[model samples]
Target: MSVAAPPPSETTIADSAQNPSMNDLVTEQLVSSGDAASFAPRTALALLHYDVASTILTDLTPNELLNFALTCRSICNVVIPRYIWAHIALTPKHPRLQVITLLRKIAFSVECGPHFIRHLEVASIHVKKPYLKCRNPWYLPYLFQELFTQMQNLRSLSIIHCDKMLPHLPRIPKAIVSLPHLRSLHLANFSYLALNLLDKLSGLQTISLASPTYNVHEFLSSTTSALQKILVNSRHTLEEIRLFEVCLNVDLIPSHHGSRADADTNQELCWPHVHTLELPQCIGDGWAPALHIAFPSVRTFASPEQSHWWTAALRDASFLTGLESLHTKSSVARGFTMAGYTTRRLVIGDDMPFDVTNTPLKDLLPRHLVNLQVSLWSSYFDPTLERFTTVLPMVTPHLKYFFMRMNRGFICNTYHNQLCDIVDDIRTLPLEYLCITWDVNCGKKRCDRCVRRSCPEPVAKYVERRLPSLQALTIRVDENRRWHWKKKKVEEDGVPAGTLSLMSPTREGDILREEYAKRIV
Candidate 1:
């Protein structure tokens, strides 16, 4: 006798109801009966077992069950082109609701779904339809309206790339409009002349508009709504009232907002309540004046090509007051370290033009800086030893973690001493983590002068000194060797080439730990 498999959840009733052989019979019966959900659960479970045993599998895996449910309908209209639309043998009416229920259950689980929700969950469901890669161009509008209406708990709604017609006269369902959970609303690529649902959301906190043809006054006048933040991605017109939008003028021409052209002929623009701002590469010198004013209470700011932007933005007493963290694409932190400014953190990398040589450690650092991560590829690698020396005097007081890479550029040279000085100065501070990497691509003889040979000594000394506050020291070294028998035998023949002597010092982890134990003890 054979054993029977248990049934799937109620959400996937069809999967539990019909077999491939019985699809025609089931559909025929469902068509005749006029209702699929009203079918007996026992009948459904029997069909599912028959199909599982006869065709699909002897036993279903977790992925198979979830995929089966997803195909039944969670993300709809996601039909693959030029491929077969394989049916699940059971066709039920309102399959979408069942899929939604299954997804909701999965979302409530302790592990993955809940984790994704916690990270992605926000006050609203901001769907950038315009950014969505069109799966099927034919049913775009209908599919969008269906998905938008289904999100019953959505609060702040941001739907980008919605056609103007949809935005101009959004035909939102009565159920969606009445959702007490609904709050702020943002629309882009939606060219609606008027939105009737604007005032319905009484708990709106932020409203952002990013349409090519935006009428600021028209949007504001349309609703007598109260909001804490408003962002308009357009130079349509500026009201003397508070506004939040960072502008980048590629041609160095300030926006023409019709009010007082002659009031301040100096063209010194200023933003008031913007707490976070991003100045792209296109912005120029005219931005300096704006930075002095808008950055009073700014907490996080980023600028890619504009090194001067950081200098100008930080010089303001007000800008440095409430500042907590700063991010730049380029290494503007090369010459400077964040030691003096009140900001606590710094992130500099590829997105910005990181030129640390120009922005010395003194000018870049704020007073209370606690954590900083400079990009590994920044020019600082070659000149890091010197830069570290200059930065140590100021950063050592508050620096907690110094992360770096020991690649080709970082060799046993003058920079080695600078690293020692930095470690010595930071020994007294609560520096807890030091993550360093060394690339040992070639055998010791092939690239004997590689940087790895130089690092162990300093690392040994630092470890022997015993950084009491340090908790974890992770070092990843890549040993790469290219066969150079020709060079090894003929080139250095007189020097007794082809010898199997180890050029790079390899220290055992146990030895390092023992050394550490002695120093700490």
Candidate 2:
């Protein structure tokens, strides 16, 4: 069985109690160069590079630093010089500082070095200069142009505020076309890029665009050949997007100030090949027809907003066609209504009801779904059980893996009951993996359902009825169960028993929720 990759370790902020000096923190982080070799190639290079920078930037002024480090001429000569032979003469006073200056100089001089001088790769000035003035209008385009020039091999790129900068730049298509190795590109402000730039990134495998001004029709008109994944979050109407082989992220930003009628009409954006759809923070009703037509092949879908749009979208759409999964703000009520899709995977939010206006699970669901993911945010017990009950039978006949995350009270009020139901639901199929995750707020009203409960009788019943196909089961609970010594009685028994059972728990809240849905298939 293929297991999901575990999440990264938690970052603990250092306090005076932990360390006295910045140097002490540095010492705490000091990895022997030998241990550093085990890091990912990129990570190792970045760490060593930054370590060098930490030593060099200690004494330089901002402008002097710019002139010495990032300015184009400085980058070409002192940073990444064209001739290593000319570098021997220009040495700084400090030991490692002199070494960094030398390496940058040698890197610039190598043949084909400019093409390889990516931002994250070398000491490309594009990433360095931005901190000086990120919001200044001129800084945006200047940095982007430099980034475009420097990181020719960039696989992923993100511009957070494209709207403020895209309209101001002249359209230059060729520069984007020249980038060859780019695989993923995210433009939080796509409006800053010309339609030509979109046309040029034909080699991209994944793309996310967020723009309120640009017309999506422009993108549709460009090229559909090389693109595999696309995301559009635009207020403007978009048309003719052909995405049969891609995973797409499409979001609509709702405006309370804009023309209400126009806002209402703008929600019907289409995506033809998308398998994953996420609509968060959008305002509109047009999503129904838009999704119905655009993503006829979609298998995974989600929306953070609760509206009739979801119900309408699922009704006329082909539920049995190419879909395999569905995710939304409310899990039980909304999911039960659209159960006709026969999706292999289902992700439901806790706060939402399992009951909706139209459709029921037996009527809507296909009996072949294999995975069930339940998100917890609601604290009530019975309601959460109802949500689980709704999807259980609909999913049981084909389900294999059940993932229950009960860090927050909002998901299932009875964590033990939810686990019991999940085991019971998998009776008809091979229940292979059961993952129970917990968060930090355990013992509180919001987290009681996940912690206060014990492994109840139903849990053992399922164990006896044991689905043999169930080979892997992971139970993850939060590590941060703490008590205020001053406020509460301290006892050895009062300390939680299963703290040692906690490996690294998943941070369900921080997860890009859409990432969970799209992979449902």
Candidate 3:
């Protein structure tokens, strides 16, 4: 007749749920007490089979693991290795100083170790508005060199730089190369000094050399030949390459498209495994032919922001012909339709190169598109509204995720009703996630569109009823406000319909724009 251990307290169970370190403590207590109780079929014994337990634990999300424990009366718990906390973590927000602090903690903290951090993004280094009350500006470079040295298990890394951070990047490169497991590397505002270091990295699957938001260092041109040289190290393993605007300030050669390079200046070097390629200014100055020859199997291609280049490229654009996904301005899509290119996923970012009234909007869309994101300036496209709406059902009948961004031009009457009609017309499709907004403020004189407006409760109920397969619907009538409906959340008690949802933003501002870029890539 051995005495039994008391059931674990609520505080202990909750702590174990959030803290992976506490998981072992909870399990050990239960085991010493000599009772399985409800504590998940003696998980400690299962942990003895290290490889099997590690594989199972790695696959389950914290929420999924918690749910599995609930089925066992929520009293018992699973043992998640404390070190895994580094991998399942929140990347601290932009302004890299905050990320530096998080790195300092994980680099030395007793519970969470550096080895678990497989991916790390030193998010931002905003020079204009530095948040320094005490720390010197030089602190960023020092922090990266120190903390990154400890994170040897790192599989992916990104360093996002602003105007001032470029000076500090020299010392940071050595620390980055220390990680043997590095697979992906993204360096925003990349300069030429780091060229030799990338060659040291092996087995890299993706490399992004992004341009700074402002063209501050326009003098140091990263030419097309340099781009080919960079890929020579990891061309076989690289699956994605984004050298957006890296060719900025290149010596321009005049052509039909301004700044278009007419000749193939660089030799073609193919990276057949790279299925995704993003070239903005890179296509200018004759980089297109070599790129076209190099990434022949690219399933996705983000055409240049210049519709003229996209239009010019379409003539010999064999790359565009085979793309499974396409991202460009509205005018580029019209050119795509004109050029006879098709893709399953289409993202038209609404940055028009010319007046959009010439082509029919519905005709521009590929009829078989499974996902579509389009941003439209309301006044620009108001002329074709009626005709486009009538044929949308026949066009995108297979759409699943549809995101529409509409900016209300000061002179133009609101297209709210017609926009909703576009949503209503596509009801028969199996559209799962739908977002419609009248919320883009382009920093010009304010429009009546920015004034606070909300749909009557009836409008939300109407769309929810019509789109039966729709799991999430987000509609923003006001710039700072929105309404969200999720199938599960809507059904819960105390969850009101048409509530003031937080940050259901369209892809407009700096933060959302970063997200927008990621979605297309």
Q: Report the number of the highest-TM-score candidate.
A: 3
Candidates sorted on TM-score, descending:
3, 2, 1
Candidate 1 Cα deviation (angstroms), residue 412: 16
TM-score for each candidate, following the candidate numbering: 0.44, 0.48, 0.61
Give Cα-based local distance difference scores for all models.
0.40, 0.40, 0.52
Estimate, for each residue in 1-521, the C-alpha lDDT of model 3 and write its tens digit.
01112222433333333325535544543464355565555334342333343345455553344333323222223322222232323233455545443433333232333222222422211122222222555454555445445555667666555223434455445655566667787777544444444446557788777773443234335433333455656778889888767543231212332223433432224566889877655545433343455666798877667665554477656667788888787767877876677788888866432233355556688877877877655444443445443555677777777776665533223345555566676777887777776653334365545334433345566677777777666666555666665555442355554442223233333243334333421
Q: After aligning candidate 1 to the native by TM-score, how far in Å is the CA of 183 from where it should be?
A: 6.5
Between prediction 2 and prediction 3, the one with superior TM-score is: 3
Q: Cα lDDT for residue 200, model 3? A: 61
How does candidate 2 score on lDDT? 0.40
Q: Give the residue spans of candidate 1 off by over 4 A.
A: 1-68, 71-140, 156-274, 280-285, 289-296, 307-315, 329-340, 349-360, 376-394, 401-429, 433-521
State the TM-score for model 2: 0.48
Q: Looking at model 2, which ten-residue stretch has the lowest summed lDDT?
A: 12-21
Ranking by lDDT: 3, 2, 1
Rate residue 347 of model 1 by lDDT.
Answer: 58
Clashes of 3: 2
Q: State the local distance difference test value for candidate 1.
A: 0.40
Off by over 4 Å in 3: 1-144, 162-171, 194-199, 212-228, 248-268, 281-283, 290-292, 310-312, 315-318, 351-358, 379-387, 409-420, 428-430, 440-457, 478-480, 488-521
